[model samples]
Target: MAQPMAELADLLTRLGTWTTLYIDGPDGSPAPERDARRTSIRDRMLRAGTPEPDVEVALELLTDDGPPAPSSQTILVRDGTVRSSWTSSTPGRGSGRRS
Candidate 1:
């Protein structure tokens, strides 16, 4: 099972507007900007050798572009609670999760 993203999530809502997305590329420095596409995670959480898809997803979400279409968002968590959820793979189970 997946664990709730708590501390980091808190930081996102309470402090910063963006989460650093780790990508496998030339390690990009963390750039703090008003937009979510400001930086990569080379300076903070992750280094090189991470998968590209995960990085892409992080960028898309933080960048406010939404997860790639046809992709079901399983959890929209805030401070360790489920705000909203939907899954193409698993239908009608959103009631089990809650904020």
Candidate 2:
């Protein structure tokens, strides 16, 4: 737990504005549900002034092919590029913010 917190601190120390996204991927959900979520994410990112390139990259990371089991994803982007991202088996609600 300390190691993870240290890593997060390091990430926060980086210079430049950051866009962090937490998404609960639509694993067993319907196609429309997934599409709606994707659209919402895109809109939010754009509204928050995230670069188009970064938004596209983040969307790519959020993709799921209707897997039987659910999963969560976290995407970090800066200056129109994806800095880091990861997926986990735990379920999570979708959200995004810039700092």
Candidate 3:
């Protein structure tokens, strides 16, 4: 998401839409490194000049330890309502580079 967020900043600079990030923790619970990763992403987005009001972040933590979610999704929410949500069937897509 390094250059991508920067690219997003460029695209959203002249627009009023926002970009929200959800850090879904491992096993639905917060990872030990969750803070670090969240900080990194937020900082990168800000450094890229993403407008403060145009950026949002949320961390979804689980109630108990369990396996990772079977799927990853992109969800759009506005005014506390889901506008859209889609899960990718492509394996290892959200986990990052495989090789």
Instruction: Give the Cα RMSD of candidate 1.
Output: 14.3
Q: Write the per-residue lDDT of candidate 1 for residues 23-94, one digit (tens) a residue.
A: 222223345432333353422323654344444444344332333333333334333333433323222224
TM-score of each: 0.24, 0.69, 0.38
lDDT for each residue of candidate 2 in 40-95, tens digit (9 for 90 to 100): 98999899888888888878778574323456667888876877777666555445
Tell me which residue pairs clash in candidate 3.
Answer: none
Sorted on TM-score, best first, the list reads: 2, 3, 1
Q: What TM-score quantifies how close candidate 3 is to the native fold?
A: 0.38
Best by TM-score: 2
Per-candidate local distance difference test:
0.37, 0.73, 0.44
Report the Cα lDDT for residue 56, model 3. 52
Candidate 1 global lDDT: 0.37
Model 3 residue 25 lDDT score:
25
Each prediction's RMSD over C-alphas, in Å, is 14.3, 5.6, 8.7
